[model samples]
Every structure is written in structure tokens, then in C-alpha cells.
Target: MPRTGDEFITVLKKAHIEWGNHRHTSTRGVVYGEGYLQIPRSEARTIGIFNSNSSNTHIFNCNSTDGFLVNASIKASGSSTANDVFAKQFQGNGNLRLIGDWFRHVNAQVGDQVKISWTSPTDIEITKL
Candidate 1:
């Protein structure tokens, strides 16, 4: 049996992830909590977070010209066709930049990186390395 993007997230929700909220803006897209997160890896898999609201739920796009994707996986709900998710990481500046990708992680310290994860339907956990 194969799982859709949403179904895949269901499984990941049980992982060792911290939880936080996702706030979206017209000029800035979306941010996980307040500011940048610290990712711990030079090369890593990023997690994009979106609000469960229908306006944003139908799609998760992060093909930012300024962001770099290490790898990604998108899931679509076979049963509902409405549930979906896109998990990808974007690189920017020095740290792995996360802009149009999903959540926010625009800053970091040397030797440390930033990462994002889904905390809830409308929340994301910003992991700092």
C-alpha cells in the first residue's frame, strides 16, 4: 500500500519533533515561530509547514529562486484529494535558507544550521542546530 503526502505526514507526526505555530504574511510568506531556527546539519532534509486552512491547505509550494532544495517529498491524499503536503529544504545566505519553501529559518550561527518540522495542522517546530 502506498501513502499520499498527507498520509505520510500522519506517520511523521509521531516522530521526535517539537511543536510550534505557523504564521503567514503577504510580504514574507510563512514563519515557524518568531524568527530563524538553528539546523544542526550541513546537508539535511527540511520540513515545510502550512496552515490547515483551505486557502493554504490545497497547496505547498517552495520553488523559491533564492532557496536550494537538498531533497523533498510531497504527498497527496488518495482518499480525500484535499489533503496534501510538501516537505523540502531550501538553502540561503550561510545557513540553509527557508523562504518560499514553507516555514522560516533565515539565520544561523557558524557550524550550525536550521530546520523546520510540522507540529500541528497550523503549527511548525523550528529546530536549531
Candidate 2:
């Protein structure tokens, strides 16, 4: 099922994901984490984590300019004491990039899914599943 921003936030909160603010006032963007959270984008490029250790995988649906659509998935596995999963999608004509440590538990699994819809600059929409 598709999830709204609030719904997605609730799910992340329940899952105990980290949260942070991505401030890009200057040329380079800065991401600071207060707890656990996920960020959504309305552009098209690359998205997903590189080093994750969760037992879950996330799927994403993305639409790009020129009517391009792509689905990206990230997966990780380990002993029952440690697992991680990260996934993302790219949409529109922009670029999407995911970074950071997804999971760090001794015996736990993690996963995520992100969906994006591009309609313009201020009309982009994202749904989490």
C-alpha cells in the first residue's frame, strides 16, 4: 500500500529509524540526525544506502523526466544478532543519493521502501511502503 508523509513517519518512528534535518543553505548540504528518520526527494538520480546490516529490504518506485521509471532495492544479511536493509528510487530529472549507516544492532533487522512522484518543483510527492 502507498503511505503518506505522516503515515510513513509513523512507520519509521515505530521501527525506530533515525531522523535528521538536511540543511542545504550553502553549496554543500549538511545532514544532522537527532534520532532516526528517512528523507524523501522529488528528483531523479540515485538513491539507497551502501553499507547496511539489516534483515529487511526496501523497494522504491520512482518516475523521472522523459517518462523514465526505475525501481531500486538494497539488501543485507547476517546472523540473527545483526541485519540491515536499504532501498531507494529515482524519479524526475533530478538526482537522488542516500548515505549514512542504516543499522547498528547486535541482533536486529532493518528495511525501508521509498516511492516518489514528480509533478514539478513544488509539486513533488513521495509515498512510502
Which stretches in model 1 have alpha-carbon errors above 4 Å? Answer: 1-54, 57-107
For residues 1-129, what per-residue lDDT tens digits would candidate 2 score against the true structure? 122332222123322332234332475544442222333321111223212343322333333222322232212111222332332222112222221222222111345443334333223333444
Give, for candidate 2, the lowest lDDT window spanning 10 residues: 99-108
Candidate 1's error at 67, in angstroms? 27
Decoy 2 TM-score against native: 0.22
How much lDDT does each candidate structure score? 0.28, 0.29
TM-scores, all candidates, are: 0.23, 0.22
The TM-score measured for candidate 1 stands at: 0.23
